[model samples]
Target: MIRIAQLSCGAEYSGIQRELERAAEIVGAKMISPEVSLEDVMDVEKRFGVSVPSGDLNLIMARATRLVENPDLADAVFVATCFRCAEGAIIRGEVRRYIHEHSRLPVLSYSFTERTTAETLLTRMEALVTTARMRGLLARERQTGLTAGIDSGSTTTKAVIMRDNQIIGRGWVPTTEVIKSAEEAFQQALQESGVKREEIQGIGVTGYGRFLVGKHFDAKLIQEEITVNSKGAVFLANAQKGPATVIDIGGMDNKAISVQDGVPGSFTMGGICAGASGRFLELTARRLGVNITDLGKLALRGSYKSVPMNSYCIVFGTQSLVNSLSKGARPEDVAMAACHSVAEQVFEQQLQEVEVKQPVIMVGGTSLIEGLPKAMEDLLGIEIIVPNHAQYIGAVGAALLVSGMLEV
Candidate 1:
């Protein structure tokens, strides 16, 4: 069995350990002998006395080279390390150092969605080039030709392959290095589409990493969220008129795009504090012992009484969860508070004060909340709709931006 070691700063998150376990089980792999362990990485933080907020990501990152370089550690096939930080070079340099000085295991260092999103942007851009090749071979002359698009966000990298106007394959992976992650996702989607690389016709890229991706792929690249979001919106629009407000809760930000006649016309996005966005919901869900996807469902039958959960700051909101638990609050009420909190923070009072006439499109990963739609509907006096493939919207939109290529 292939063994993998997962080490993150104690300050980073235990969730990193949990995710490593889940990935291993899916691949029929095993954990390292010690499974999960931590080497004190708090020295740097102690030196600063406040969250590094900018340098070294975390203290643990700078020391990875020393920990993984142990000579006895040759058995690992995968080494997944999560570090919170500011620069990609800082993270990648340490991983390279460990590989050269310690074990030779194939390694991947994870940048939690907060700092930088996507696994490898360059890799994914290259992979989309491959996807474009496959599109041509699979259905060169079909209007529903195979095509690929990628959306790189602050939190995740999503890719999708569509064949002749119908959905055939899709992939949603955490965004790290936008390029590499994009390549992996595009390759995976093509594999599922059963088309080899030469069959792809074209590729499109959109979002935070789009400019960087554009520098890599020979295919077309776009940076407009409006175009990209709309590309995805049309697929999920509830009617010819569609939903009134599109709520996009992204990893680092939240955007409120108003839809007029099924197209985005104007928008508002929250500031860095996350007053209105997806991260708050994700953090809240984690603390509540429920997956974000289960959050909406959990809120379905909750009592109307709420704890008033709006806060622009994610850190303050976290503290709020702790306080609520101590006060003997039900998880459901807290979940409702979370839903209401994000909605209120994400949109203007104009958004809340207005008795939501249009169906709200809760886009992005937060829509996965199983109970949020209900809680939101209850508080805002309006219904919410989470699309089946809401998570892939950005990727689909990005791929759609790929210019039609000469079938080669």
Candidate 2:
């Protein structure tokens, strides 16, 4: 079994440690804590250049040091802290960064509430285990055969056809029934690519409805979005050999992943509210009496500073949009404010959990929104790459990875 070292503060006291262990076990990995002596704990601040008044946090640092010194003690690292503890959050990021920089271990950092459950941490644990166990698969630079990938997402279903590492055809439509939407998109791709279903050597499925779609399509691989999306983003951007960050703001949730050499190290997903997602922008576009695609270009023509937006709640944000319009705020200004609102929340809620690396790749359908990526670029103060086929990322990733399973 893969050993996933646990470096955490307050999980035991908060009574969520069992959930963490159970999550690891469900993913076929064991969660272990590295041993640290009292002296090691005492000298943690001296070694790491960070001091904390909490004794438990200091002990956590000591364990991090031990893991760094003895990289073989764990195959991957899980660093967690209490959601209510501001100090613990800072330490969590620092410890995660330290581990990723100092060792080859894949790191996953999370902030747990008292009600956190095994299901909540299962995907993350599984992704960490996949990154550690399947490094060779993740490192494959090219696709070798004809393949198909399907992404059944919350708001839309997408499919892509790739032959010899080249995307030949793609299909996209708003999601309705899971299987129906997947099949519709898949058929569209097949018709465009001029290939029969049986001609494809491999198939992969991902996103929210992956299991159902995978079962229906007899998919060779079914994976979560963290690893699959990261792989596709890096592959599409042609940044397979260096440190990079990927941001995908989906309709219902968001994902921020930090990767190294095409393999994911640390990632964060989900948000407290839909105000941080593309759904909020859809609502904003509706209230502004324009199509969603036009919102981004409209925002580019206006200044967000003239409008005040609520980034914490979707309902309140809609209300703010109404109020701003009542006060005669420009539609363009409201649009820009909405884009900035979602970008700021993503930065606070998800991006802070992992280290931000260069060559940031933004994927998903939302990346096509001009204002969203522009807003992200302004906030991060770096150029963000939106590669070709950004909207078909999950499908592209699924297709690329499933090709590895074909016999040479």
Best by TM-score: 2
Model 2: per-residue Cα lDDT over 69-150, one tens digit each: 9998999999888897999988888888888888889998888988999999987898899999888888877987899999
Cα lDDT tens digits, model 1, 221-302, are: 5544544564465555533253366766777765555444444433433344764567777777788898877877776646
Alpha-carbon runs more than 4 Å astray in model 2: none
Q: How many clashes does the backbone of model 1 have?
A: 53
TM-scores, all candidates, are 0.59, 0.98
After superposition, the stretches of candidate 1 with alpha carbons farther than 4 Å from their true spots are 1-144, 238-244, 301-304, 349-359, 403-408
Of the candidates shown, which would achieve the greatest lDDT relative to the real structure?
2
